[model samples]
Target chain A: MVGLLDYFRSAAGAQKGSASVAKERLQILVAHDRAARGRPSYLPKLEQEILAVIRKYVEVDTDAVSVTYEQEESHEILELNIVLPESSARS
Target chain B: MVGLLDYFRSAAGAQKGSASVAKERLQILVAHDRAARGRPSYLPKLEQEILAVIRKYVEVDTDAVSVTYEQEESHEILELNIVLPESSARS
Candidate 1:
């Protein structure tokens, strides 16, 4: 009887652990999806325009420029990263 | 002997499954960390200035605005979300 009880107890514990793990994974995935869906409609156009302006000054691949906008507790941030070809490689 | 072999097989399979799961979680966490670390240093200042400008026009709590920046395969996205208090509540 004790052996059976031990088996059941271990099984329940394992089930609970798996359930919590699944819940955590789901929460993280949902948060990522929500953030993706909340992106502004104008963002693509803005990125394109910015890329165009950068291309005017230097030759760069379309994928070389990255722009990120982040919001913090107190404010909003606009971060732009442009990966230009190495100068030595340009020659 | 057959039962013992079956037990070993199941144990090995479980170990393999957990190892893969751990590896996948680590990869996702590492990617998130890398993206966060790549953020520009000027982002905080930019966010502060933007908040100040917005505050000039409307009163809002510090957490009412959220910004997210994402880099996609072909382009980068800058997303901004702002939550304003209901006008009805103002009266």
Candidate 2:
């Protein structure tokens, strides 16, 4: 065997310490970035804030406000969108 | 001294072929999935369609629909969001 180095192999760099630490650091940094760029730092707080903000203004007909993680060029961007009851206007 | 293997250190794993190849494959697969899931795969086509769809439905005050890459659970998800002129309703 030429020594498989992928996730399927034993030496797939899947070691707990190194890779896990790396992943954690990366995620935390990303989360921080999102927070800085007007995204909620924590998931729950973000969800709450998003709903609160949308509900404060628009007449929401459906529950579609959602938050998810996305990596872009090693940076994460948080998106917030809502579906409002059509009243014929754009604000 | 232990050898450094991160992107910052000496053995920075930033080798063109392997890392670039992996990124390419991942991007391709992700783009394919986006196409299957009702997203325009190519940037140009997608932008065109997005504009077409929005224009046909609403009177646009500003352009808002945008597509970008987001990483989630080792996979990338492309999000499409349109900030139409407050014309409400979830269709």
Candidate 3:
């Protein structure tokens, strides 16, 4: 099946793990990093969008859904965390 | 076969995308981030190690290999780029 590995293979070709590809990836990652330095005005909109996506399946603590990015040594990750309330019945 | 997917699945089970996981990942990524902020005195040693790995395969421009860290938003990337000379014979 076509997946991330396939994409990487097609993207890198014979120059897999080349310096140029690394630099390009870094440039993109850094650009996103710089944009998210502060709380930023669009944070609310983003949060709402995430909440909406989660709300579609089940009720959840809106505040519990957090969307963030993370990077470490060539690993650029988009992290999403959501928490739902206990299954107890509401009074 | 055991791959990254297996590793990630094992690492995060029911709380695969939970905020706590996000925070943990961020902590680890950021630690690496802060450590790489400066050129760091050990850069030369790292370069030598990397050059040695590449040298095992082909002769390359020792100066061409560059290692750098980039941070964006929540993305931290370890970027490594190397350039090699052409195949032309030396005079």
True contacts kept of each: 0.00, 0.00, 0.00
Residue runs of model 3 more than 4 Å from their true location after superposition: A1-91, B1-47, B71-76, B88-91
Per-model TM values vs. the true structure:
0.24, 0.24, 0.22
Ranking by TM-score: 1, 2, 3
- The CA lDDT of each predicted structure is 0.31, 0.28, 0.32
Q: Is the docking of candidate 2 incorrect, acceptable, medium or high quality?
A: incorrect
**Lowest lDDT 10-residue stretch of candidate 1 chain A:** A24-33
Ten residues in sequence with the least summed lDDT for candidate 3 chain B:
B24-33
Q: Tell me the lDDT of model 1 at A63.
A: 66
**Best lDDT among the predictions, by candidate number:** 3
Residue pairs with backbone atoms closer than 3 Å in model 2 (clashes): A70-B70, A71-B71, A86-B88, A86-B89, A89-B85, A89-B86, A90-B85, A90-B86
| lDDT tens readout by residue for model 2, B1-91 | 0111111121122332333322111111011111112322233333344344334433443444444544323222333434433322223
For candidate 3, lDDT tens digit of each residue in B5-88?
A: 333333334343443322211101110111122223222333344345334433456465445544333223343444434431
Question: lDDT at A11 for candidate 2?
Answer: 22
Q: Score the docking of each candidate (DockQ).
A: 0.04, 0.06, 0.02
lDDT of 3 by residue, A1-91 (tens): 1132332233334343343322111111110111122222222333344344334434556465444544333233343444434431122
Model 2's TM-score against the true structure: 0.24
Error of 2 at A8 (Å): 41
* lDDT of candidate model 3 versus the reference: 0.32
Interface RMSD of 2: 15.8
RMSD over all Cα atoms, model 1: 19.9
